[model samples]
Target: MDAVGLSLMNEAVGGSEKCVSAVREAFGAAEALMIRNVSQVAKDFRCCQTPKDHQDQVELMQSLADIVMGTVQYNEESVLMSISDLCGVMTNQSAAYNEEREPYQRLVKLSQIYRSSSEEPCLDVSHEKRVKDLMDTTVQSERRAERQWTYQTCTEFGFYQTCEDASCPFSGMVTLRSQTEICLELFGISQNSLPGRVAFTNRYYGGDEPHAHRVLYVNGGVDPWKELSVGNRTDGGEEAESVFIRDSAHCADMSRGRVTDRRSLKNARQEIEKHVESWLKTAQQEKKRTE
Candidate 1:
């Protein structure tokens, strides 16, 4: 999910204050499920310790780990959808406000000041133009400022780290007040605006990949880069490198396919955590071997 969408979900699930708890809950739930799956895989693999069986088990475990990672990606998408729904409601309300009889009369009066002052004296014109420009700039700045503020505020309230991006954080109640405060400060439109709240929401989600650093595969593949290329040089100065390239079709034969339901997702998460743990162990062993 984009930062904004994540924030909005944080809001919808439990208001801005409880956003942190909600996110933690979601993450924790997924983790627990993943752990369970890993345990089951381990139990099944433990019965077969023959060298050939061990090799098959290792491949199966890695595939299970991939499914867990996929679940994390899917959960992020689910959270984004929930946030989008909340944003839709806010947009409808804002549209209705524009059609209201006495909607923000103060801002309307301010607009008239610009419209009527167009033909005033050159000095007066220049001064008014300058003032208007300042106001416009201020409004834009404030809107941008507010977006930053709201993102931080949501983070502060929810206890989620503010996303590195200035526009939105990973979690919190992303409200219209927060959105408008950002827009007015940045863009200068108080009532009618292009793209509107949805635009803001899109910005929140669209920038998610860069923010999350989630891996993307070129094809429906798993661990295509699993085999690290380790180079060695002979005494004669000839170079050699070991590269293990798995057949993609053969790898697919090992996969369980994309699992999405909660049970499967939970299992996937566990499998991933197990694989990560195993990877860490292997890495440490390799380091020791090198040492």
Candidate 2:
């Protein structure tokens, strides 16, 4: 998520001074490693291939780099681990592999890194013992949830975050086409079908303009997902409330109340609590009426 990266870079807000310093330090170290891995991959990939082949390799490298940087929940240790994995995978290549197998090998290693780092396992890996160790042997409790979310992406949500914008910290290689390739490979969902599916989802839910009652919508100003949420009620029909937590990260207010939490997040949680209290009182009154 571009917004996640931006939030990490915001020295003035989002996190406490110590947390922010640690994040920046970890991110900087990881970024340097990732860039080196990219450069090495690029150098190896420069063997006179066809134009299409070159483009494909370039895109693949970019997609892998994006994964290293685009993890939604950024923990300092996790960032360091991801970059370490990238560096390990890139440098662990054997001389036995021919040029043709290089890309496939890289794909497997990158997929392993992604799965080990994220909630959902993306590409399946069947490679070296080192790589196999990266994936947990035991099945995750969230397997079903991850699969359901993947299915949603294929059939409805299509919430693919690509680094296409010029200001994005990741390489521009992460295009819409590159992002959707997984849908085709994993779920047989074609890229052509995604736009329609996403449209249907937005239409069905009213795309942040839903006709609902007593609903409280909350979003963090620095979270990119906020763009898809109800910022303001346009129809002026339903009295839906939306609270924007300025200078906060995703779900910052939902976390346990911390001394390090910004003032905006604390206030947002108070506002949410007020709404919940009001709703409880209204429900009690309705029950009394029915009785």
Candidate 3:
């Protein structure tokens, strides 16, 4: 009886091993079949069947089977539902690729509509109107003029301030030339005597004037009295006010020898012109000296 019982136990063990091996072989075959189906579908859709693509699809299908077979657990019903959803997505993507001609035409039409709509309004506006709109905002004018100035000046300039007070003009130009010059000197540009640079003009005017304010001519460009503020809090919590302070100092020093000693709007125009000419002359002399 003991020997018979031992033989029966051995038979049961062998049967279990065979079942496990069969299941593994079946899983591998099912995975391969899924890959083959996906490849055929991709080929029909004229998409490239790359090795990576095949591997991805095989893995996906195997994961799906594992969930279905309860080899991977968490909600078996949810896994089954997800497999159906994946099939729907694949079908839609396949359809989109297969009917390529109509979709391509629609895309081309949409792009044409976008291009036409974007360009037509811009072209419809008159040149004068466009210029007026561009200049209407003080910030816009400042931004457009900024690149013409040096990087330091660009950083120093600020937006225009509007005044509704009848005593004041619609716009007021604030001079920051003194600030800029001081900073330039500190940077070692004007070591000996401050180089003669153009003074910026500040103007306040109201009413119907074509040129509401006079912009000073400097280096073949206009210089308006605009204060540019710069500096930021450093990591060490120290404020580097040297940049603005130096610029203001330079401006004050240069203002001393000017024909008009005042900082008024009228003096600003004359002084700026004189300073500009001085700067040009100095530049030419330096060039000749170097040559």
Candidate 4:
């Protein structure tokens, strides 16, 4: 998700080092504000004592923090656009993109409000109302797919993008505990069971060192998820290949070839095509041998 933000930031700034630093500072400020709001909300929730059980209060905090972390993903278009608008303003390119854009205007208004008050603006989300709204909404097919994916994460793959690492660009509020608590809440999968489950999955599938043939492991340099993907295998026994596109973001090679694409990305796509062609030819040869 941070990769999405970084890619979008680079696009918006267009190589302006000044705008890059300014946009990073702006993102840090936004993260700080969100952390402050979540902290205040947690304190208020604990003190309110609205007949909720201790367990329920803890679950609510986890859920709320999960919501806050969701804004950091690419699914939240508004957050991405806000950052893009901030970048545009810093680079003096907002008018070039859209003269009628409202994001910059809204950002300006928000800045004005922040300047006028001694207290920082807080985003106060009503927990009860939020829960009610979610309950009242109808679940769609896309949401069903999401539920299935979430279950896989809880059961087999603990692929949670947490901010526990010091190098993570996001705030520390997005912890592994906050993510694991969701599994407990939804599927009765405790945090304690996650390690064993993930280990079993790795053992079953040979996680990083899979014994395979004609497999191409392609990854983008800027993509955070690439850390989990198979890179260069030292054994060099399998008919597998790895291509590292240093200038690309997530799934960049999956897109249609563009004239503006970096040379590394273009070469990577060609390499993937070569792998596919070789696999098809190998399959044809095996069919002839069987016949």
Candidate 5:
């Protein structure tokens, strides 16, 4: 490797090692041990897939660790508790996404261990910052989508629920997604909306095409975003499959059970678990091959 490349590798691994050490000390031995194992499993494939250069990845994660450690209230409690809360959300989040089982059961285990033993901890600065960031992102995304929809309507002459073309499939089902915008426009109360979809275009988990392995794309039949999904666009390859949950809304499988949840939702999650296990086996086989 070139000197620059070596430096990048050193930085990334160094930052990651520091983070692992800090977390191990903070979360306790058993949980920490699990973290280490999961870390190992993750390292088998996770960071390698990122398109971001190693320097950027290292610096970002290092900054994240610095912020987390700085804001953490107590080493023994807060971080784990916060993580447990996140895991609890994940358990319920599956149903929303048409997911059934926990797969590895990591979140379930974390929830049990922390919820039973710990008190409700106050949000540390790190938690507050993360939550606020998410809220901001969500609001920004909604604004962008609304603006884009409006622009598309005006430019492409897309109907906002009007059945001008009687044969159009979207005529009846597609309502004004933005009630607030409709109310504003109808009342002649002009509110400043974002100009375009730049914000939405930028907000992402990662890229598409080659880097997305072990990625399960689950969507609901009723989901507006179904057209943009893997299942909608193409037949799934070995590592990527997008399954649709019938009669479910967005991410319905990711959340906890509701009495209202459809039986099809349950079946959808079973399919998700099957995909996840397949991914795990793939990862293990690849690891063995490398070793």
Candidate 6:
């Protein structure tokens, strides 16, 4: 998900000239990705690919705007009026994206067109330009909020949300509120600049969907984020494997060992070492072949 690129946009607006170019390109890439995501789901997200109908698209965008605004503090409605307007721009961009995908998906061709104005294509270049510009604006605004949360309150904010949903040892709105005040004192930002609580809470939450064949997923049962992690539904097999330590802290296996380390942590680390060595063996064989 290009998390590094996303984090680089933390300066929000009026950053240094270097950040301006780097963030611009990074956001441009993300805007393309968002378009691809919406395209995969379509305007209504029903997995339909019919691009001719766009009346309902505007409403879908309004719903997204609602989701985006729901994360901010309530009193900032005045400032949100302008931010909400970017939803329309996103809608237009999504719609324009359809023009470049007729007969068959020419996403690559259209992407090239988006990258360079001089590239010739079988679609409206001017419309493509407009979509690109609007996407730039839309991405910049969303990323500004993301950057604020990333640099300021990401970890505690996520755990705080987990506490709100379930009992968490590190969870408490009091900490969040207190930290918000501290953030304001330390940095000139406010809670309003952070991404919505929903987005924040789901930051590390993922489904049990299958991943790479050799990938190893380690989860600690007591880990607050363990409530959501890859499943250990199957017995050991050739594909993906998950090692879950019910009593261990999150990511405890990755930490350097200590005599006081819990049994679960020790077991998890051994499993990790075994898997890593196996992967290295496979990689070395592949390298020998390539050589």
Tens digit of per-residue lDDT, candidate 6, span 1-291: 121112112233111233223323333442344456645434222322323333223333322222222311111122232212322222224666566322113323322323243243222212223233333435556345544454435333433331122222111222344334333443455666545643544454423554347778787543435555666844446346888875454466766688976576788889888978988898899999999
lDDT, each prediction: 0.32, 0.55, 0.29, 0.54, 0.39, 0.40
Off by over 4 Å in 6: 1-206, 233-236
lDDT against true structure, model 1 = 0.32
The candidate scoring highest on TM-score is: 4
lDDT of 1 by residue, 48-68 (tens): 222233223333332222222
For residue 73, what is the lDDT in candidate 4? Answer: 32
RMSD of each: 27.0, 10.3, 33.8, 8.3, 23.3, 21.7
Off by over 4 Å in 3: 1-263
> Per-candidate TM vs. native?
0.19, 0.61, 0.16, 0.64, 0.32, 0.34
lDDT of 4: 0.54
Using lDDT as the measure, name the better of candidate 5 and candidate 6: 6
Q: Determine which window of 10 residues in candidate 2 has minimal summed lDDT.
A: 123-132
lDDT string, candidate 5, 1-291, tens digits: 011111112221122222233232322332233334634422321322221332323322322233222222121123343322332333434555244233234323333444344363321223223223333435555345545555554333333332123332111212233322442443333333322322333243232442466677787644434444556423347666667764454566787765655688878878878888888898899999999
Error of 5 at 120 (Å): 28
Q: What is the lDDT of candidate 5?
A: 0.39
Off by over 4 Å in 1: 1-149, 152-180, 183-262
**Inter-residue clash pairs, candidate 2:** none
